[model samples]
Target: MSSIASFVRGVETLNGWVGKTVAWLALGTVLVCFATVYLRYALNTNFTWLQEAYVWQHATAIVLGGAYTMMTGGFVRVDIFYGKMAPRNRALVDLFGTLLFLFPFMAVVGWAFWRHFWSAAVVGEGSPNPGGLPAWWLLKGTLVIFVALTTLQGLAMIGRSLLVFGGREEFAGTSSH
Candidate 1:
């Protein structure tokens, strides 16, 4: 039980750190977008790499922050019922949701994205547009990261649910809901 608690804490910590760190990319995306617009409109010039940079940053931030969103309970839910459920019942819902839905979806997406990332890496894929950024494989790899982090968080959720079932809800990590 203690070990399970530790696992939950560890996964949550990792996802929290990753999510917070990647969240900075949102600011970078905005700044880059502003710069791109300024350069294009004010100076009447554009750089493909600059344009693609913001898109990459935006995508990376969103993808990598998924687990964090789950950890913090930021993902949308049909709260009309969920919000009114007892703790144990909520745990049951979370358990089944993770096992029945999240895990399977992650498995399928992970495999598909892994193949895409691998093929891109094998060929050293780059942006197709002239003057666009290089190393498109890096962008594709974010999908793999997304799948991994979300799956790990799902495991943590399962651990939390088990803790609740065992009447050790105190051992559950500080999940938002």
Candidate 2:
């Protein structure tokens, strides 16, 4: 039980740190977008790589930030019913949801894309656009990172649910050990 709690604590801590770190990418995305607009409209300069950079930053931020959002209870839920449920009921709901929906979906998608990321990395795939960003494989690799982190968080949620079911009422929603 202590070990499970410790694992949950570690996962939450990791997701929290990663989420905070990737959040800076939002600022980077905005700045790069502003630069792209300024360069296109004012200077009549267009750089495919620079444009792609903002897009990559945006995608990376969103993808990587997902686990963080989940950890912080930021993901949207049909709370009309959930909000009214008792704590144990909510835990059951979350446990079932994670088991029956989230985990399976992630597993399927991750399996489907496994070869794609592998091929890209193996071949060092690059952007098709001339002068576009290089190492496209790196960008594709974020898919794996996203899935891994989200899966870890999902496991943490499962652990929390188990703890709640085991009578650790304090593990209701938050991922504190």
TM-score on alpha carbons, each prediction: 0.96, 0.96
Per-residue lDDT of model 2, residues 45-152, tens digit only = 999999999999999999999998988788888899998988899889989999999999999978866777899999999999999999998988898899999999
Which regions of candidate 1 deviate over 4 angstroms? 171-177
Candidate RMSDs in Å, in order, are 1.5, 1.4
Worst 10 residues of 1 by lDDT: 168-177
Question: Which residue ranges in model 2 land beyond 4 Å of their true spot?
Answer: none
Candidate 1 TM-score over all chains jointly: 0.96
* Number of residue pairs clashing in candidate 2, backbone atoms closer than 3 angstroms, sequence gap of 3 or more or interchain: 0
Write candidate 1's Cα lDDT for 29-104 as tens digits.
Answer: 9999999999999999999999999999999999999999999889887899888888888899999999999999
Candidate 2 structure, TM-score to reference: 0.96
**Model 1: how far residue 32 lies from native, Å:** 0.2
